[model samples]
Each structure stands twice: as C-alpha cells, then as structure tokens.
Target: MSSLWEYANPLKFMRTTDWLLPIVAVAAVVVTTTGLIWGFFFTPDDFRQGSTVKIVFLHVPAALMAINAWLMMLVASLVWLIRRHHVSALAARAAAPVGAVMTVIGLITGAVWGQPMWGTWWAWDPRLTSFLILFLFYLGYIAMWSAIDDPDTGADLTAVLCLVGSVFAVLSRYAANFWNQGLHQGASLSVAPGTRMDWAYKAPLYTCMVGFGLIFLALVLTGTRTEIRARRMKALAARERMA
Candidate 1:
C-alpha cells in the first residue's frame, strides 16, 4: 500500500533505479539490435522510395520520440512545479539532451529522406519548421537550467519554459494534418487500416519504436541517478566549507 510518491525520496529512487536501470538498458540493446536487423535486412524495399524507405525505421521512431520526450519533460516539469520534487526537476533536466538528440536525428534523417523525394534537402514545411523550433526550445531549456545557480528557481523558470515550448510540440505533431500542402506524409503506422503501413514494414517499425522508447527510458533513469549523486556531492562539499 506504499504510495508511488515514496520513490520521490532521493535515497529510495536511487535504490529502485539501481535494480531497474540494468534491466532496461539490456532490454534496450537487445530490442534495438533485433529491430534494426529485422528492419534493415529482412524487409524488402518500397516500390517507390526503394532502399531509402528503410530509413523510416530510424526516422519515424526518432521523430516520435522527439515529440514524446518533450511531453515527458512537460509532465515532469509540472510535477516539480506542483510538488516541488527535486527528482522531478532533475528528470526534466536529464530528458532535454535526449529529446534534443532525437530532434536532431529526426531533422537529419528527414532531410536525407526528402532530398530525392522532394528534390531538396530542406523545406519550410510546417511540421519540419515546428520541430526545428522545438529543438531550439530544448536548447533554451537546458541553458536556462545551467545558467541559474539556485536549483529551485531554475526549475521554476524552466517549468514555465516547458509550458511555452509545449505549444510547438503540439504543432510539430499535427501540422502536417492541418496543412495539406506539406511534403511530409501522414502517419506511417496509423490505427486506421487504410492509412496504416503494410505488415512487412509495420512489424519491424513497431519493434523499432518500442526499442527506442526503452532506450529513452534507460537513458533518463541513468541521467536522473547521476544528477542525484551530483547534488548529494555538492551538498556535502558546501557543508564541509561551512564547517
């Protein structure tokens, strides 16, 4: 009957993660390797895009995570703002770099995919533009946290920044649907049977998505543990200096 919030304690969180991190990390590696092998090798090429279509396994997953990681941070930021949980704040901080990397991967892969298809490497497409802006917001969020010395104050400011950046996150996900003029296609793995991917492509794509999600979870856990230890060390150093 212990409440979930009990894990908010730094010591408890560390203990839980110590056991949990390795499992998630190993699963991430196994699943990601399996999905990539299945996707890149076993799968046949698309009739139109040919070999380039394989890139979707990576691009789609990264793009999805890029937006999802921001959503995770937004939720964590809210928890910190309302509950004043240090762990929540640190989790949000940890996710920024991961989310930023996902955004970069999405952008790069999209450009690579677009060059032949769209006759250009870049475009002012609404989704692409909004995704780029989300990346910038990630950078600003990370920088704002580093610039402020007080953890609580920094968390407060960054929480507000997260709220602001969420607008772009929403736009990034739905801009293609809103503006039909864009080069980007609709969801590759939609629930609608008509729009969903073929079984050959969809199967491995789903696997890759799960793998990427596991990888993100493992990374955030690792980052949160490091941040917690660093905070502990800093507090100890300050106490020694005061003594």
Candidate 2:
C-alpha cells in the first residue's frame, strides 16, 4: 500500500506522465482521426436516418465519455478523500473541463440528430433531460472548485459535490431504460447474445470510443501536470515572501 502511494508523489507523477503523454497524445490523434473519417465517409448511411445517422459517430462516443469522465472523477475524488493524495485531487480537477466538453458535444450532436429523426431539436425526454442535468453537474463541480481559493478546501467541497452528483449521473445512464418511452434509442453496444449493434456501424463507433477515452486520459494528464506546476510556483512564491 505504501509503495502504491509512492505514485502520489508529485515528482514521481510528473516523471511518469512526461514520458506517457506524448505516446497517448499521438495515439489519440491517429485513432480518433481514423475512426471519424471512416465513420463519416466509408460507412453506409442508415436506411431510415440517412446522412444524419453519421452523427452517431460523434454523439455516442462523446456521450459515453461524458458519463465515464465524471465516474472517473468520482473515483479520483474518493481516492483523495481516503488517502489524502494530491495527485488524485488534481486529477479530479483536471477532468472537469474535459467532461464538460464531452457533455456539450454529446448534447449538440444529439440535438442535431434529433431534429431529423424526432422532428424536433429539443425535448424534455427522459434521456435528454437527464443528460442536461449531468452537464449542469459538471458545471457546478467546476464552479465549486473555482469559487474556493484554498486548494484543499476546494477539493473537499467539489469531492462532496461529485459524490452527490454521482447519484444523478447513474440515474442519467439508466433513465432511458427505466422510462422505456423516450425518443432516444436504447444502448447501441451490448454484451448479451444477438443484441449487439451490427458490426457495420459498431466497428468504427467502438474505435472512436476507444480514441475518445485515450484523448480524455491524455488531456487529464496534461492538465494535472499544469496544476502541479502551478501549485509548486505558488508554494515557491510563498516561501520567497517569507524569506
């Protein structure tokens, strides 16, 4: 356990991420570019939805990351609370904007797809409403962090908010299934036999999902590094003032 905690040391964390970032960044660029191009051009249009169906390549992946990013933050927050790990707290902080961006992308793409399929750009459907709520949670989490000047205090406040918001996030994920009447379609990918999405659409979509996840990791690592540098600068400035 103590050895595992060694990774929480800022110097160790920075040394590891310095090497890992470039590789993750390159992979994110290559894989995401490939997946987006393949999905947009190579894949056939849906019989019913036509060209607009291509938006799923963007929408679904962003939506998946939107939820997963918050989940990641929640876990990071828990680690910070339990272990007093600075890296974990900063990781949760670094993830907020990325998650917010993903949520916005998901919502925008969803709206665009909906206009053609559902005959409206916006609705109070369960899925849409829950997702909006999730976005608001992201905003709130970010706001809470910014509102507090003390880093530790900010982390504590936001971590509590994240824990509370997680309930709603989980609700957002299962809302469509529970309601069963939303215009939004059900899950595209599944593990059960014969229920999975067709490979024609699924292949590029899954690739994009992986790419998005990698991109999220890359962004978090970059942002966490920046936070660490800023904290070090602040501490140095304080020490200089004392001297």
Best by lDDT: 1
Q: Give the Cα error of residue 13 in candidate 2, in Å.
A: 0.6
lDDT of 1 by residue, 56-153 (tens): 99999999999999999999999999999999999999999999999999999999999998899998998989999999999999999999987789
Best by TM-score: 1
lDDT of 1: 0.92
Off by over 4 Å in 1: none
Q: What are the RMSDs of all candidates, in order?
A: 1.1, 1.5
Cα lDDT for residue 12, model 1?
Answer: 94
Per-structure clash totals for the candidates = 0, 0
- Residue 232 of model 1, lDDT score: 89
